[model samples]
Target: MLESLNESKKLLPERVAEQIISLIADRELKAGDKLPNEFDMAQQLSVGRGTIREAVKILVSRNILEIRRGCGTFVCEKPGVVDDPLGFAFVKDKKRLGLDLCEVRMIIEPEIAALAAERATSEEIEELQRIEDEVKELCDKEEPHMHKDIEFHEMLAKMSKNMIMPNIIPVIQTGISLFINITDYSLTKETVRTHQMIVDAIRERCPQAAKDAMIEHLASNQDKIERLSGL
Candidate 1:
């Protein structure tokens, strides 16, 4: 997770930047290899041209990509070690910025949970149940289950069956790094109860119960986290 993010904080353009870079590295987009044009790349990447352009510009400055006049940008053969956007040492700080980001996630995720409960389908419910079981196993074994937790939440959002949900989901994921409360050491019975309640409500197709459960679960933590951190 941190590795993906380590590269991400450097690229800042969007996930498309990461997507493009990964393709270049994994697909071996060689030097002088003419890319299919902007529109084509956008279609292939399944994103807008603006996202591609932003990614390309970032790559260009990093020297991993070079744009030629009227032709196209080509990958670098041995793009000299690209300097880190913040001097190769952009370690995530857990101080001010971290807490601020966590506070924002608290505000967004509860609503998403409610939406999920309101709209989840049978298939999505099954998927969410599977994720919950996996998370519970990981937690029981005292393993680092942050990724599973993230996946569970993401699946729940997708189950919410709201089209607008895809966009908001990533924002919540962005700050999941500082989620020290997720690991087993801090996984209180109350937390498990809250999540289980959400799952039960969603399974029952009770939207209001789901919303109420989520709000009740999150509001306490939200207030506590905010007041304690003074966010």
Candidate 2:
């Protein structure tokens, strides 16, 4: 149940949406958790059912909640930032978008690797190794390993153990994927080597080594992308 809203407040729907978002952030709600029915929420928030519906609609547009015809509303798995999360559509220069995304990866991922090294659970470490092995298998077969490579990075983000990082990394990665597809990129042996270096550093729990490895990896990729784009 929620607290009563201030009677003097205007825009009750917007305020209700803010409170609901706060509730999610406070962990009173979580991914895939079903929200109370609209009538109950209206009662709890001391608003009319129409206002509650409007608030739910707002959250739905933000990818925070989904309503099933008969099953009621449930929180999204990622909870927010759906559909072109980086706002690439608004950027008039797509090539600049690619380079900017590379810069972002260079900045954020190394620290994420460092955190994963410091905080990954033993099982999480094993999972990373498992993904690496899968990529190696694909590499050996000379198959398209890009999807597996993306999965490996995505899992590394999950292993970082930073609550907010897990949410943001996927959005950034989506931007990176767009850049990669635009460039028609291909994997290189050096890329595999760098990935191995990062995995080994994390496996040994060497945070600095993991961070350095990731920095090198992203820097190399940036250089390659720049070359391919003739920039």
Candidate 3:
């Protein structure tokens, strides 16, 4: 169910968008859940179809919704999280950027891994293992595994089960990308080894082991950056 908007609202589209977001929360819609058609939404919210369209566009820009041609608008996998939330792309000095991201990861990711060991469900751990396996396979074949590596880290964040953890994914992703580019995959073997250690620790539900493994994993990246940058 949706609420009707006051006609005197200064920005009807914005008001309508907020109402639609409320409707989404009220209905407990999950990612990929399709919203009611434009006509239906307009009728329910007592707004013009144009207002609904504009509102949907706003949600789309915020990464909360996606419009699929010939289908319908649905929630994003990581709703309300933008692709580059921290604007890492605009930084001119990538070497410094990579080191800085490594610093941030050192502070946050080990704790995240520990939380994941504490909270992740069996199914989530299994999924993480699958991603880890995929990454190792790619690395063994000397193929491009950066995406899978990013997926592995992202899966770890989701396993943390902290509402805020998933929002930090883009930062982790950016850091991973920078590491791969800077190292030129020179640390592939070390990375794969540390990833397996992390997965093993998580599978055994050893929080300290998982935390230490994550720290080692990130520290390896930092070391590589420092050595390469002649620091």
Q: Tell me the whole-model lDDT of each prediction, alpha carbons only.
A: 0.66, 0.83, 0.86
Report the C-alpha lDDT of model 2 over 98-198, residue by residue, as the tens digit: 88888888888999999999999999989988998888888777777777888888888989988877777667777767655533235557667899999
TM-score of 2: 0.85
TM-score of 3: 0.84
Best by TM-score, which number? 2
Over the stretch 1-231, how does candidate 3's per-residue lDDT look in tens digits?
A: 676877764688888888888988999999999999999998998878998999999999999999999999998887887877777778788778877777888999999999999999999999998998888888888888878888888888889988787778656667557544564468889999999999999989999999999999989878987887778
Query: What TM-score, computed on C-alpha atoms, does each candidate reach?
Result: 0.55, 0.85, 0.84
Q: Order the candidate numbers by TM-score, best to worst.
A: 2, 3, 1
What would you estimate as the lDDT of candidate 1? Answer: 0.66
Residues 1-231 of candidate 1: C-alpha lDDT, one tens digit per residue: 112232335544567666677767676667767656789777776666887899888778777788888888787754533543223134455444546555665666667777777777788888888888887877788777767777877787777667656545655454434442433336445556777888998888777787777777666555555555555
Better candidate by TM-score, 1 or 3: 3
How many clashes does each candidate structure show, in the order listed? Answer: 1, 0, 0
User: Candidate 1 or 3, higher lDDT?
Assistant: 3
